[model samples]
Target: MKLLLVDDEPVALRFLSGVLAGRARTETAPDGASAVAAFARALDQGEPFDAVILDIMMPGMDGIEAARRIRALERGRGREGACRLLMLSCLDDAEHQIISQYDAGADGYLTKPVDSADLLAALANLDLPENPLDGAE
Candidate 1:
């Protein structure tokens, strides 16, 4: 699967990469603004990721806003809706932001520090083995 893993911390990024060691197409972003820009570039190149694992809190343009902007761009590009945004935050109070994230247009949420098995399970479910049209399906 094509995955974009976004976080401000290098250690977290490295940890995620290690956890997703077998998932070869994963990309990393250091902050929300760059994440949005990268997402846009991928769409422009006609090769967007299957999922985006985003950190909720960042220095600028937090993940929520980035997801919202990406959704707007998706609509402009004639895409049906925003891509699947999976929260990869360390926030214990994740439930408090569910409504806001949904409103901002996230498809799913996961808390950190991530458990490899759970992360893989969620990704596997999102990327169905029986379906090849996952990215656009």
Candidate 2:
């Protein structure tokens, strides 16, 4: 899978990328703006991400807003099914937040300090191809 991993903190971004390195083609964006830009560029390149793991809190634009915009962009391109979005936050797994994320177009949610197994499971739950590398071959 081609994954976009977005987070403002350097450590979290590095950790997520490290965990996903050999399993998928992963890209990183340090903030919401860059993430949005990267998402657009990927679409333009005809190699859009299969999933986006976006942090909920950021300086300019939060993950919710970014998710909304990304969805809009996908809709505009008529490629709404092209990607799955997973919102990440440090907030408790409250019902409201999960509801809000779904409203904003997130396909899944994961609280911060994410468990590796859970993260992988969440991706699996999206029903993506079992072997991303299969596409290349």
The lDDT values for all models are 0.75, 0.83
| TM per prediction | 0.84, 0.89
lDDT of 1 at 11: 92
What is the C-alpha lDDT profile of model 2 across 40-74, one tens digit per residue?
99999999998899998988988888888889889
Q: For all the candidates, what are their Cα RMSDs to the real structure?
A: 4.0, 3.5
Query: Considering summed lDDT, which 10 consecutive residues are worst modelled in model 1?
Result: 128-137
| Number of colliding residue pairs in each model | 0, 0
Scored by lDDT, model 2 comes in at 0.83
Candidate of highest lDDT = 2
Measured by TM-score, the strongest candidate is: 2
Q: What is the lDDT of residue 85 in candidate 2?
A: 88
As for candidate 2, its clashing pairs are none
Runs in model 2 deviating more than 4 A are 93-96, 130-137
